[model samples]
Target: GGAKYLFPGIAGPDIINFTHWLGALVTSMHTIGVKDTPTRRVIHRAADFLPIPLLCIAMVLKGHDLHGLYIGPHSEAFSAAADLSAQLNIITVDRPFNHVLSMPSTMYDDLWTAAKAMYKTEPAIADGGEVIIFAPHITEVSYTHGRLIDQVGYHVKDYFLKQWDRFKDIPGSILAHSTHVKGSGTYDLATNTETPRIQVTLATSIPAERCRRINLGYLDYRDINPQTWQGREQEGILVVPHAGEILYRAKNLSNTATKGPHRSISGGASTS
Candidate 1:
């Protein structure tokens, strides 16, 4: 119909949501410019793209499903947001350099402690080894997928190679992306067979299948606390909390004393 052609074209829910939000942003920008008839019409049209944001507001007003807390007052909302930020591995921390891994959660501490107890601690991770950072589905999307690298203040050597080839090529280090799977296993994808690996699980709810498929070595979130690192483990694997936010490097931390001023290591990785 002719009426359909008068407005933006939307394919589905996802597209509509993004377009609507974007439209709102564009409309906001329009407020700073001239307000003509066509501009007004565009602004009016963009106003309709508020379903998702409205839904989010409603959810927050009622209380988040994950925690079931309705922050009524503005101050309370700010407090809640701060607490939420910390939980998401985003927060303001004022501290000096230190060797101890100030892990965010008990789950992370247990896992790292166990791995350290089991594995032969390496003087420098760059000597040779792999680190597999894993998290739950939500965390994977929010933090682990790729955002965690920025929060940790490390630059990817080759952005194009990593994006196109799916390999994080940090110098003297084998950084691997974690995949969500039903079972557990490690796959040797490299030509060389002597790469060390670390498996860090971020509070996953998957069954312990052990490293069966891809042999990067395996560490289960469940296996921590209850069980210490089994016998003698190979390499060093650490499952950090807020996997998207924290990428621990021995050299970086060990040399933090000589480094520049510290910055707060918190915030969500921008998907953009």
Candidate 2:
């Protein structure tokens, strides 16, 4: 039994809001829960958007013993849902994001920096594999952290005083969320960009008989309940982690606003 804190940015007003369900004291309710029911699907779609992951957490908490179909970038939310679901019977698939991407093709500089930091500094994702999982060249990169790791969850709070563009743009596009158990609170980043909400559904449902037409190499399904998947129709997708490290060079770049080594980020959205 754990608590989930959904941020206001990602939580849309559908039927649940992050403040409502996640905000409520656990002492009050225990059944299938929703942090924000009336979630505005508009901000729900962004891939890096965090609120949707909260939804996934809510789902697993309520339906830990269910057969679900999931997809998208797996982060703290994904890990939480998967663990909580506890083999409740779920299948996840991978697909290109259905919404406007935060990480655009034009963001080469930002992407390069994030890729380097992820491979170099972040031990959680870089340990077992090469420190730089992507590429030393940095034209493109991708990686997944199979192990549980910990990173400080400073979010908007730990930002250096100076608002330099170099350190942020990339990690901003991709999610910097941690799957570590200690990461439960919110830390605001510099921007309050809107995201999208896309419900996960099977993009393609072809049976093994059609294997000749398809290459089942990418499919990775982890069964929760052996009873449900036995001779039954079920599928899972493979979602890897897109982890990165935050560059605090801005503080040194401009010290006027940069207070001290500890006083790095400022003017970030307030998160209590």
Candidate 3:
């Protein structure tokens, strides 16, 4: 919970499972007794918070019935989930500067590939009763959703407005306060908030917090005809399913948006 970012709240053998630092903490305790009880009590405090953390994991994951793995820039949520491992279907990944969609597209592909390889769960089954809902932070999606602004779907501007409102309501949001487990990289509610309209660092430059709103809007407004949440096409059914679903979806969507606008001249004639 402190600088280590591991589950220090939990005491006993469980702490050993937290991180390398925790194993050391336990080792230290065995070899040398510390004066402060806070050091020892952290593990139990974590143990006590188990049920609440589990409830949170359930709520965050309830959007999709499948295995919900939260790839975070930090591991607070996962550590919290670790306590109630029996009740939760979740995994966490923490990489510095890796706040959701900030990573490259290749990284996302690699991540999905690795996850698929490891879990080996069919996209249909892993998706639970409904589609799998994988919600990343959405930084890049904000800048890119504008290209799809005029397409036959919701306007990017209006989409962002709704997204801002909804983000305040998500499970672990400060406004919602509904989740027992806390989200990592949260900003202080009192300060460090700014509107893109107010403080102009650059054209359309918004703070990370507000930027999140735009990204959320992108997700809400996307033309999913070409994309997969967990996996597969929503409109097209595959002969073999999942394996060819993405390619199948690509065929149905307007390729112009993905590749580039068509470049045929009005007076073009066949020239040898």
Candidate 4:
């Protein structure tokens, strides 16, 4: 649920903070399942802060005979979904790569959706690494939020945190989008310097000048060929085809390996 609906009439930083808290609460529910006293307590506390009517409706629906609830820390369908997610979304790499070529599909028509390429690939990248988002079709940073994004540019979370007064007027969601694309890093208060953990480059229709202005590196899409990047994982260069949907992680950090039969790719080989 969106903040506008869940936290109706509320605006600015407080709502954003509450939304973040709600997300964390929901994620915690996933670990222990939702059909328990702890989950009910959390929801009850949240209801006090939110509209009581919505909670009343939810409570009424909980006992509805038409509804089929899968309250689970474990269930057959849940296990199957988990297994499928591992096969499709989780790609395990032997080590972090210095360079990654992320290829977004046609669904990513603009930078807003295309940003997933960075999100999905960040965990597999080494410090000071570069992720080249290769999408010839993407010509705008964000169709809905381009002007706001242009004014802010992309930066680490600390950039906004250390200098909150300068950016406090901007919407929290836009600030979040800016930081996520920039990836993790540090910002120095004394020197007013920001250093991102990874360099995000664009190989797209968006111009080099605009890319630079937005604090992103640009490469002419025509100059590169996807074929050259294929089958070169050993060189610390990764090519992820259909990039945005899958998540790439270093093997050491992954809790569960991908199981069952699957076809092999250059950087991601299925782990038993």
**In TM-score terms, which candidate is top?**
4
Candidate 4 structure quality by residue, lDDT tens digits, 211-230? 88888877777777789888
Model 3: CA > 4 A from native: 1-88, 92-174, 178-222, 225-272
Worst 10 residues of 4 by lDDT: 55-64
- Candidate 1's C-alpha runs over 4 A off are 1-68, 71-79, 82-213, 218-272
Q: Show where candidate 4 strays beyond 4 Å.
A: 1-88, 252-272
Clash list (residue pairs), candidate 4: none
Model 2: CA > 4 A from native: 1-67, 70-130, 136-159, 162-272
Residues 1-272 of candidate 3: C-alpha lDDT, one tens digit per residue:
22123353333333543332332223221211122234335544554554544322221232235444443322354444333432442222121110011111223232122112111111111111111112232223223233332221211122222345644332111111110001011222356331111000001112334333322111221222222222322422212212211111111211110111221111121110
Once model 4 is optimally superposed onto the true structure by TM-score, how far is the C-alpha of residue 206 displaced, in angstroms? 0.7
Alpha-carbon RMSD to native, per candidate: 16.1, 20.4, 19.0, 9.9
* TM-score of every candidate: 0.24, 0.19, 0.18, 0.68
* lDDT score for candidate 1 against the true structure: 0.27
TM-score, predicted candidate 2 vs. hidden true structure? 0.19
Question: Mind giving the per-residue lDDT tens digits that candidate 1 earns over 30-134?
Answer: 221122334335433553554532111111121224533434432243345434433532222222121111124324332222222112121222222223333
List the candidate numbers ranked by TM-score, top first: 4, 1, 2, 3
Q: Find the number of clashing residue pairs for candidate 1.
A: 13
Highest-lDDT candidate: 4
